[model samples]
Target chain A: MQGGVIALVAEAAGAEALGAARGLDGNAFVVTDLQIAYLALGRIGPVVTSARVLGTGPDGRAGAVVELRDAGAGDRLMTVVNVSGVPAAVLAGSTR
Target chain B: MTSDHPVDRRTHVSDYFRLERWELPSDGGDERPSSFGGRAPIDDHQRGAGGGLRTGGLLTNLDTLGGFTSGLAALPRWIVTTSLLATVSELDHVGPLRFRADVVRRGRSSVVTALDVVDEGAADRHVAAATMTCAILDPRAMVLDFARPFSLAMPPPQADPVRPEEFFCIEPGAGPVTRLRLADQLRNPWGILHGGAVAMLADEAACRAAAAHGADASGPNGLAAADAVLHYLRPVKVGPVEARCQVLGTRAGRTSVRVAIHDVGAEDRMVTLGSVTVLAV
Candidate 1:
């Protein structure tokens, strides 16, 4: 797989989690950091991803961690930690 | 019976390694012309209408050449890449690329190799530098599990196939997401996807994300990758891996991006993580 593609996949996972944790409504977000560590090779089928919020910044941004795993055998593939900033509007919405 | 020519058998070490050269293209010349005899250009799509070499392609070439160079020193043993770090200063139309690899440390089980790609015209200036850590595994002691659990289903053949591109291509997916599929050609001899391919994917995603955030607004020179670090967590064996990217921040015309690659089937698992910095040209 290409590194860009992998990054996109990982970013998508993080974005999804960030959306769930804080309803963005219509605010924009920017990524600050992304770190990935590979665990195993996926030789069977499609890989799945999930993410969790690590923390939130005072400015409404958040840090998230995402994981990729084998879909068939459920083997872990990679882990990603992403830090992103959410607009203040989205943060206000979450507080409500 | 000896001829007038005297053989200097001083053990020419350089001959043991393969030498490859890239000739600089003339002004307005095609940087990457079609290799398949007049077929469509191989890098047209990757150029993104800018007509410059993609950063991902450059990294892939660096990784492949570095691996080949390391293999010469690892003789009788296989070298597996554990990690790689690359930094690029410029990647415009500059060419006539040249690279040489040097073994930094040779241990019993692992070796560290440093490779530098430079422009032939300016020998002192480096276009990109990469360091790779490889583990030496005894070939005789290697175990082959041919019966490993691999999917038997194959991807449908391309409708109009031409020569394969050197770097992996990306397709836009749902907002800020990109997708790629694994093919046999992209796999290493061990039947797993090559690590270089993974690096290319990560670099591409990071660059695109940076570009999306107006990182390329500094004239038409385009964004150049300043540095990148890749951590390989596992082997990618499946199809349709997706990549997501986020722009961490920007300062002084440089943008930082964080990217994650995940298996599409398992939306919760990650396959790789990367951090890249791009400077506006």
Candidate 2:
């Protein structure tokens, strides 16, 4: 789950972060770590995940932490820390 | 003069013990073979002595989940479990390893079984549990061509290890640590380190670190992960990690420890944190 989130957030963050960021297809996030603290059991549709981009680096590695929640109730479910590496080739999706 | 079966004095005790210990001697003959290639041969005695050593004791049955979890801390625990289970029953793996087998109930095929592995240590601190169902398989039992073989190399010792250490140790002068590089092969179908890589990474670090923690110069050490549930907090890029394993303690035959996979950088963030327990086999 963390790996998928890393790919999601890295690609999303890269696409959303300004400068030499953003994933090539908005799907190439390479996760390095995922620290999760379970808050509640998610038992509904479309779990909402909000990722806070930590930062990027010159070494192709990146980091972020995402909070998962129940989409309808907005109750926090799980927190995941994500890390990824952005390749230089796909570094142009972000206009923010 | 050549035989897979060996026998000797200890064999004699066991043979004699078998004569008195239990009515069932695996050998149907009145006398157990006393040496390898039974010709009343002398060379067979030395080798067969080791055979006698093998028949000493049976492992005690674990009764509670806590003790069951504790018993699993030793790798050999499941060897007896799986062997006995496989000898009599069948298993089906639903996920990577969550398995279901029939446990013994009241009648025909009376046993059923299911097991789940949580790699991370449970908050309850139990590592894992493998449940088994037992019932007599009739001569008329229809054999089901069950599942895939779950074979694995036992985790190596704390000294010189055979596994690849994926997490790198980049410290300039901090003694010896395992170095694992993520260059070409680590990439997934998507050209990045795969999620599976993290487990491989965790395995390499945990087993090797166990060896380094418990093994000595003689090297015949055995300390492998009793329990490990991984949470990929971040993805490892093309760089290396300095795998650090801090020994917490060793009790009975188990070793409890903590591990942090860290990259040598400014943030110095720990990519993975694990509480693992290993026991000598």
Candidate 3:
């Protein structure tokens, strides 16, 4: 559960899908589009969420890569590479 | 640099005040029609506002969406707004909704994508999740000044329109209430996420179904949803769940889709069910 939380933090901090996620408005954390497949149930562990800005679209759609894994004392519960999110600035900027 | 042509046509906006200058047409008002060939059916069992998950934070500070620029530095702002603009709930009873996204496939003129959202730490529950594919927008074609005199139609989103993955497809192949989630986020203090949230999810799934219908059938005749009409079963408390989405078919250029968000544990039970009809433009 926290794995998803960590991933979201990266997104709010200006991280794209790779770096983080997009916000719905005001450049914070926007969940424009999303799809998640439940691989396994929530498990306690040091889930490591790392993101990197993959690329930016000419229209302001930036992509990022997010990798989540339970880095605690257990097996890798979930390995999801979500390719989603629209930059908050993309929408907020238009308001200018 | 600033909001000029070419450079301003599709570059990042450095200021918030400048973004608001792109006034949205007030004529259409907030009531966007749900039908093209026909109007979307308004359900009778729908739950009125004041319950369920809400859009929360983002609705209050929509300007934040403008600050972001797609990875492509030269894209226009409106394109970003329609194709990539996202929202989440944060800091309140339904506090802290976070969003994430990325592009999976890129076409010469469009792009395929996906994304996810979670509680910012409120109640410590991953309430909802979703995936989407938005196309790249061109600044040359769409102008804020030109859009100034527009109605409500914010130009059809220029998407890859092609399915990047079979999973992302929302085209329903079964019954009207397929792939409905059993559990969802139940933190809408502002009553923004309940019925409205249901409508949003249903619309999204229906849109996917519409796109698939358009691609598969190919033609001005293919059917897509003119609007997604949802009847709220109830404002059931969402206790962490994923709904199932099913695509129906395209009829008269209107693609109809159905989805039910229910409890993750009780897949058999239903929370909300509805269908969307997208017209093939």
- Candidate 3 scores a chain A TM-score of 0.54
Every candidate's DockQ is 0.02, 0.01, 0.03
Residues B32-122 of candidate 3 have per-residue lDDT tens digits of 2111110111111211121212221122112122212122322332222222222221111243334333333334544333433444444
Return the TM-score for candidate 3, rounded to 2 decimals: 0.26
Candidate 1 interface RMS: 12.9
The best candidate in terms of lDDT? 1
User: Considering lDDT, where higher is better, how would the candidates rank from best to worst?
Assistant: 1, 3, 2
- Rank candidates by TM-score, best first: 1, 2, 3
- Write the residue-wise lDDT of candidate 1 on B117-151 in tens digits: 65554443445556666777665644433221111
Task: Tell me the deviation in Å of residue B151 in model 2.
Answer: 22
Backbone Cα, N, C clashes tallied per candidate: 48, 38, 105
Cα deviation of B81, candidate 1, in Å = 1.8
Measured on C-alpha atoms, candidate 3 has an lDDT of 0.34
RMSD of 1: 18.3
User: Chain A TM-score for model 2, please?
Assistant: 0.55
lDDT value, residue B202 of candidate 2 = 47
